[model samples]
Target: LIKEYLPGVSILFPYRLLKTEDPLPHSWDVTSDTIAAWVAKQTSALFIKATDVDGIFGEEKVIKNILASDFSEHFDSCIDPALPEFLQKNKMECIIINGKFPERVIQAVYGRPVHCTTVKGNI
Candidate 1:
């Protein structure tokens, strides 16, 4: 069990019944929606998203920081389509880093600067 390994970590699996028939819930949609709802009721927390690449790319280079308002459908390949809108609407922010390197992930959790993309909705 996860608790056995990381006792301090709390894992939550959230699901909601949709009105649409036979529509499978998209994982990213669930994540974004769940975060939005939880953020409304809790203290602000850093959202770190791990992926294969270093971060979001633009013009063949990583975009260190970007505004949610500047996000477009073209970025759906890198993140969930619903996430940008959710961040902008909620005035939240998230950092994207490469999961391939565990050390970077650790650094991120510790609030240390790392080579990553920061999607800012808090602007």
Candidate 2:
């Protein structure tokens, strides 16, 4: 249904069931893990995470690029604390942009420069 109506947009709801005894996972944790697992099977993958904010910020300014190894665990509000570790483990990269701006997302998809933060995992 999404493909027939959405044209180019693809949205996946990252959800899964677990045992009652198991602890629930955070949405971002599930998403990050899912992306990591998917990337492991593919030859290449580009993770474009669209969120409400422009990108990760430092000192109130947007950080254009940052290594996953350098990402602070304290800032889990913007991204899952597990994301950096997952990215580093998978050697994958994620481009974070504001979903409010569709043009920027399209630009990121086409490998064009845009206002976003790139989390480099190839450490």
Candidate 3:
């Protein structure tokens, strides 16, 4: 559907097989962050990640724009266990926007303000 809608965009999907004895059997051998970092290095393109929420929140559900440097400080409380450490290792400037809003994609691509988690770090 994405290819059909956006004709010129290029997409690459890499898959890995893991043994059950491994810690994360259901997850990819590489983390999403790692893949994102590789993509950025290879293409020099902006990587935007859209999720169900506006962005990561604190215990009180406060919404704040977080820089990559702040991730380690907030990692324990903010990160989703399913996400791999490699993905979060570098501040791969990714935006965690709300996917429910269709226009959010457009806004993100156009560099507009949108609710998201921006990881700031060397890519």
Candidate 4:
């Protein structure tokens, strides 16, 4: 489906969504965040997820920028546990922003100063 809409953006949606015969593994660790990142990888695009929270909370604060290693410490709380590993292995970054503030998404995409969290692949 992504290829059919090449150069365009679309969130990852499983073939049958909640239906059975799941093409992908059925695991709690493989949530929407990981699926979105996987689609971006296959398409060579950026990955983003707008969640309800302000951003990734860590060390008693909303971490604006963090390495995958450090973020993994709080990964289970912020996102699918497998995402950090996948991003690290692929040398990719994921921008997590608050859906309440849609404008922040644009800033994140531009790598600007936004009230969001950027999870980097490297140390």
Structural similarity to truth (TM-score) of each candidate: 0.71, 0.70, 0.59, 0.75
Please give the lDDT score for candidate 1.
Answer: 0.69
Question: Which residue runs does candidate 2 get wrong by more than 4 Å?
Answer: 1-43
Candidate 3's displacement at residue 38, Å, is 2.0
lDDT for predicted candidate 4 compared with the true structure: 0.75
Q: How far does residue 63 in candidate 4 sit from its true spot (Å)?
A: 0.6
Task: Give the CA lDDT, 0 to 100, for residue 110 in model 4.
Answer: 79
Q: Considering TM-score, where higher is better, how would the candidates rank from best to worst?
A: 4, 1, 2, 3
Pitting candidate 1 against candidate 4, the one with the higher lDDT is: 4
Clashing pairs in 4: none
**Poorest 10 consecutive residues of model 1 by lDDT?**
13-22
lDDT value, residue 64 of candidate 1: 92
Question: How accurate locally is residue 121 in candidate 2, as Cα lDDT from 0 to 100?
Answer: 84
List residue ranges in candidate 4 displaced over 4 A: 3-26, 71-76
Model 4 worst lDDT run, 10 consecutive residues: 16-25
32: Cα error in model 3, Å: 2.4
Question: TM-score of model 3 relative to the true fold?
Answer: 0.59
By summed lDDT, the worst window of 10 consecutive residues in model 3 runs over: 16-25
> Where in model 1 is the C-alpha error above 4 Å?
1-6, 16-43
Clashes of each: 0, 0, 3, 0
lDDT score, candidate 3, position 122: 44
List, residue by residue over 6-98, the lDDT tens digit for candidate 1. Answer: 767665433332333223345655455345334432446677888899998889888999998887766554667677767776777778899
